[model samples]
Target: MFKHLLPRMRERSAAANRPVSLSDMMEEFWREPFGNLSPLFRDAGYPAVDVSEADGVVTVKAELPGLDPKDVTISVENDALILRGEKRFEDEQKKDDYHRIERAYGSFSRVVPLPGKVKEAEAKARFEKGVLTVTLPRDAAEAVRNIPIEGA
Candidate 1:
């Protein structure tokens, strides 16, 4: 029954560098019931992250809707910033029947490479409106500067 979907998905996967995880496929299945409907974005095992390094600081922003700050963890590992979290889907009313569940929910872990060395202990993190922002101070000693040389 799903023969066409497999090949199409495979072709897409081959075209894109990032491999779609199983959770993403499951979410796609649950949300996209009809073939004609537009397929929702799938971010499996990782959230959409934007990382920028400028003015002696590194800033990372991640989109994690419907997730609490307490459930998230930020860490610096091997010169990379790591973000891990889980968005739990609660059944507030057991009597309610869901017609369409388009929101993707689950645990995710992602790593962003730093542009330069950062002061790990001085990092600041903030979560507001289901978005996570992490600010890291860059190490001054790691900054590159040209050294003057005398001709012999």
Candidate 2:
């Protein structure tokens, strides 16, 4: 029944030096159906992100554990902040037997819409302790204006 996913599951089993069981294949079949439905879902595979604006500056933070700063790329395009990174699979040369592997290893991209106009040229990013913080100074000249309503 899980023929389509057998090869992929076999590779994972081989990587862990374990045999793939029928139950394991069934579990993977159920889990793969919800892939990338929405960023609102916690299992969407995208890193956790927080965005806030204060004092004409917009700050964005993303959690990226087990990733080097160089592996991540940040950019601003179409008034959105784009975060891209890859977490490579670690291959160990030890003789220890594996039990469970839950960490995700692959490339992920996240697009966050900016709250307002920002100076993309002056944007700054810093990575500290597996967290990436990006600061973007908002453009005051292009700030939104509230027009008074004359009549309905």
Candidate 3:
């Protein structure tokens, strides 16, 4: 039966460390965003994000439409860039005035692990035209830090 195959598919995906499927990816996009998964799933939610590093600077750009700049918060924790925000959908002033509102409303958090250390205090973030961009300059003294292998 199809029900039996669904669970088996999930088990295989977990074992292989790969995304379930394109159809399954769409399902996950509707259900919950994949913050725990790889960055390939960055475009899975209401506001998708794009991250890149260049010239000793790491930039993170997120699509946040219909949101005020003050409604969002950006912070750094343990060398990781954290973006947190909420979006709300309000239809009409009176409930009886409108039929319904199918817009999605909720809070989202994105934690991006930096490739190298960043100066949190010196970082700059700007929200222009619904796009949130955070620019982080790499640490000067320690431009490149070696990540240690565990149980290798």
Q: All candidates' lDDT scores? A: 0.82, 0.86, 0.81
The deviation in Å at residue 36 for candidate 2 is 16
Model 1, TM vs. native: 0.65
Give a tens-digit lDDT track for model 3, residues 1-152: 57768777777777878767665566667786666577766556546777798998989898988899888989999988888888876555655665676666789887887877888888999999999999999888877669998995
Highest lDDT: give the candidate number: 2
Which candidate would rank higher by TM-score, 2 or 3?
Answer: 2
Model 1 Cα displacement at 126 (Å)? 0.9
Q: Which candidate tops TM-score? A: 2
**How far is 76's C-alpha from truth in model 2 (Å)?**
0.5
lDDT of 2: 0.86
Which regions in candidate 2 have their CA more than 4 angstroms from the true location?
1-45, 149-152
Instruction: Give all TM-scores, in the order shown.
Output: 0.65, 0.68, 0.62
Clashing pairs in 1: none
Candidate 2, residues 16-102: lDDT per residue as tens digits? 865587756566668775653674683443788899999899999999998999899999998899999899987785776779779
RMSD of 1: 9.8
